[model samples]
Target: MTVRTRRLAALLAALSAFAAGCGGESDTDLVRDTVRSYGEASAKKDYQRICDDLVAKELLRSVEAVGLPCELAFKRGLQEVKNPRVEVGEVTVNKSKALVQVRSSAEGQPDSQDTLELTLEGGEWRISSLAKAQPQPPQPAAP
Candidate 1:
């Protein structure tokens, strides 16, 4: 092959590698998407969908430890609220673990904000635990 053709081929390969590394979405995006899906399911009161996205017993135990009444709360909350909206903000991903923040509002009232911890298992991101995000401390009065 001509030197010019070989150089062009090498350049294309390098560009492809770079694009795969930086241009395309990373695993963090996948985790964020999973978190969004969870919020959508909760807002829609789709318990099965939420369960499908969870990591089963292990995750459930963690959630329960934090006093999250998964089945009952989801059902009751869904029945009480109307037209819920969930906004996902801030995702931190480290290797196979991630934390996602979600703010949910129901019936035009701000409900509660939560952070969902997740992990990559069997090539799929699953919720490991759900915890209420602590509210920011009040700012001091200015002098």
Candidate 2:
């Protein structure tokens, strides 16, 4: 093969390798993606999918503990909130656990921050718990 053809083949091979490596989602991205999917599902009122797939089994159990199934309970909670919005911020992943910072708001409600804890369960990232984000102490003013 000519030198030019060899160089072109090398470039193609390198590009293919890079593409393959990037095609799969990183753990951080997977965590963010799960949160984003939850937001979209919430907007569409897809409570079943959220309970059945997006959340961990333990969370689902808690949802059902009030004598209502997961889907019905979630639907009730969201009934008054219109245009629920969720924004995913910083994400930290350690082994099979992850913490995601999320900002959310809905009609007539103030914006709020929450932390979502996720675990790698059955090869999927699922939200295990959610709690209000703790307020950070004021940092000393920079010099």
Candidate 3:
């Protein structure tokens, strides 16, 4: 495992220990919280938190395979996003997997909505894949 992976694993372990009492939190709420945390961490350039608390191991592997650490990849990705904001929408869960619908928009850019896949690991949800959905066209108003 890479350094980022090890960090993330440790973070997850710590979270699991504390999350035992948070069983009352709904799945949607948990997913929403995770996305919100990601946004906050991104704004602060907290790459370690992003890797440990936001994305999954697979994502880390993909970044490392590309010859960049996950933290650097996250930083590079953030550069293209101006005034980034995210709103979590519907969350669909199936067993250990989940898909969170999110609407995100940046300055001078049209809204981009996507479904973020997540996995339940160590009693916490971690982002697995980010597949961007085609932007929906504006609907015409009816009389």
Clash totals in order: 0, 0, 0
Task: Provide the global lDDT of candidate 3 against the true structure.
Answer: 0.83
lDDT of 3 by residue, 60-121 (tens): 78878999988888888886767778888888988878888898777777787888998888
Candidates in order, TM-scores: namely: 0.63, 0.77, 0.75
- Descending-TM-score candidate ranking: 2, 3, 1
lDDT tens readout by residue for model 2, 1-143: 99999999999999999999989989999999999999999999999899988999888888788899899998998878799999899999999999999988878777788999999999899999967665444448899
**lDDT tens string, model 1, 1-143?**
99999999999999999988887667878887887787677777887777666554576665557676666655764767677766778899898788888876667454677888888888888988766765444448899
**Against the true structure, candidate 2 has what lDDT?**
0.89
lDDT for 37 in candidate 2 is 92
What RMSD, rounded to one decimal, does every model reach?
Answer: 5.6, 5.9, 12.4
lDDT of every predicted structure (CA atoms)? 0.75, 0.89, 0.83
Question: Which pairs in model 3 have colliding backbones?
Answer: none
Question: Distance (Å) between predicted and true CA of 31, model 1?
Answer: 1.1
In candidate 2, what residue range of length 10 has the lowest lDDT sum? 130-139
Candidate No. with top TM-score: 2
